[model samples]
Target: MKNARLATATVLTAVLATGVMADAGAQPTSLMDGVYTAEQAATGKALFEQNCSTCHNADYYKTVLQTWRGQPLMYLFEQVMSAMPADKPGALMDTEYEDVFAYVLQIVGFPAGETRLQYAGGSMEDIAIQPAP
Candidate 1:
C-alpha cells in the first residue's frame, strides 16, 4: 500500500512539473509596463461609465481576465470590438476601445505604463495578458 501511494505521488509530481515546463515555453505573459497611461486610463474610466457601465460592472474584470488568461490581448480586443454594447456592435471608435481597455486595466489594478497603449494590429497576438498582479 505504501509503495503504491509513493508511486502515485511521484507520477503526479512529474506530471505537474511537465505542465509548468510547457507553460514556461508558451507565449510570454504580457505586463502592464508602459502599456497605457494614467491619463488614458482616466479617460477610459469616463468612457466606461458613459458607454459600458450599463452592461458591464466591477465584476467585468474578474470575468474577462479569468476567461482570457493565456490568450492574446488582440483576442480580447476583438471580442470587445466585435460584439459589445448589446445594442450596437462595433459602435465605439478604435481609440475608444483602447481607452476602455485602459480603463479596464486600471480598475483591475494593473499599473499604467508611461505612454498610452496604441492599437497593435498584428502584434496584439504576441502580447498575452498576464494575470493581475
Candidate 2:
C-alpha cells in the first residue's frame, strides 16, 4: 500500500510540473488578434482623416518600409502611440491608438488577417517585416 501511494504521488507531481511548464511556455495574446473588428478599422480611418490627415498621409510609412530599419509595425505603433499628431502627442486613448494602427496597416496593404499584430517585446533588429503580398 505504501509503494502504491508513493507511485500515485509521483504521478501527481509529474502532472503538476508539466502543467506549469506548459503555461510558462504559452505565448501572450497578440493585440491584433480579434482585438479590433473591421468596423473599428473604418472608424479609425475616419478619425485619422479628421485629426491627422493634414500633417501625415497613409503613405507616411512608405519610406520606413523601403528602408526596412527599426521596428516595422510595433516600432511605428509605439512611437505613434506614445507621441504623435505633432499637435497633441500622447493624448489619444489606447483604443484610438489601436484603431489608427489598424488603419495604418490597411494603408500599408498588409491585408487584415484574423490575427491583429500584437506588439511583441524584443529588439527590432531581428524582426523582419516581409513586404505585403
Best by TM-score: 1
Please give the lDDT score for candidate 2: 0.58
- Which parts of model 1 are misplaced by more than 4 Å? 1-29
- Residue by residue across 30-90, what tens digits does model 2's lDDT show? 3233333566678679878866889877566666565533223455567777778888887
The per-prediction tally of clashing pairs is 1, 3
RMSD of each: 6.6, 14.9
Q: Give, for candidate 1, the lowest lDDT window spanning 10 residues.
A: 20-29
Off by over 4 Å in 2: 1-37, 68-72, 117-133
Candidate 1 per-residue C-alpha lDDT over 1-133 given as tens digits, one digit per residue, 9 for 90 to 100: 9999999987886676446436556544365655778899888888888888898786767777866665667768889899887688899998898999888888887888776676754545555676676
After aligning candidate 2 to the native by TM-score, how far in Å is the CA of 132 from where it should be? 5.3
